[model samples]
Target: MNRLTAVTLGVADLEASAGFYSGIFDTPPNRDHDGVCFFPLPGCWISLFPLGHLAEDISPEVPKTRSGFSGVTLAHNVKTKDEVIAVLERARAAGAAIVKEAQDTFWGGFSGYFADPDGYHWEVVWGPMFDFTDDGALLFGKG
Candidate 1:
């Protein structure tokens, strides 16, 4: 219960979303089922399923339509400030809209944001206080 294994985004178009993610991830999906796609990362997986179906799976009470902000953001951390800009540009080229340009953060870091085709916000960030494990999982704090 303490660990997060995956983050599933309910997307509008399965094929388009899959393609968009594949392009930015630089790899094909590890698994594609009748209604879902999965991309495996270093520490977890990103799953995409149709919005309506995802809502149905949750419960009949959940709304199928999404609007405004979902109050959630996915993040990709980089090793340097330059890499943050690079990743944001890459995402833009892959069909994401640049929601926020790369800039310095009040916490003494660099970051920016982009909205995916499904309107999901992804933050590309670089923090001096962050590091990575040998296998590439994002590590917080310098201890």
Candidate 2:
């Protein structure tokens, strides 16, 4: 219960979503089924599935409508401030809408936001207080 192995996004067009993510990652999905795609990331995996099917898979009562903020965001952390801008630009070129231009954060970080085709928010950040292990697991407050 303390670990996250995957984050699944309910998307309108599975192929388009998969292609979007593939362009961002510069790698093809590890698994691409009829209506699902899985990209294996450093610390976890990201999966895209048809929105309607995902809602039904949750419960028959769950609504498939998606709108507005979903109260959750996925983040990509880099070691340098320039990388933050680079990632955001890469995402924009891959078809994401830049929701917020990169700026200095009150938390002493450089960051920005972008929305995927399905309107899922993603933050590209670089914090002075953060680092990563050799295997890419995020390390915070470790000097």
Q: Write the per-residue lDDT of candidate 2 for residues 1-143, one digit (tens) a residue.
A: 68899999999998899889998888998764777899988889999999999999999999998999989999999989899988898899999999999999998899999999999999999998898999988989968
In angstroms, the error of model 2 at 42 is: 1.4
* Residue 74 in model 1: lDDT: 94
Across residues 1-143, which tens digit of lDDT does each residue of candidate 1 receive?
Answer: 68788999999999999899988888998663778899998789999999999999999999998998889999998899999988888898899999999999999999999999989999999998999998989899978
Model 2 regions more than 4 Å off: none
Error of 2 at 81 (Å): 0.8
Q: Give candidates' CA RMSD values in order.
A: 1.2, 1.2
Q: What is the lDDT of residue 37 in candidate 1?
A: 92
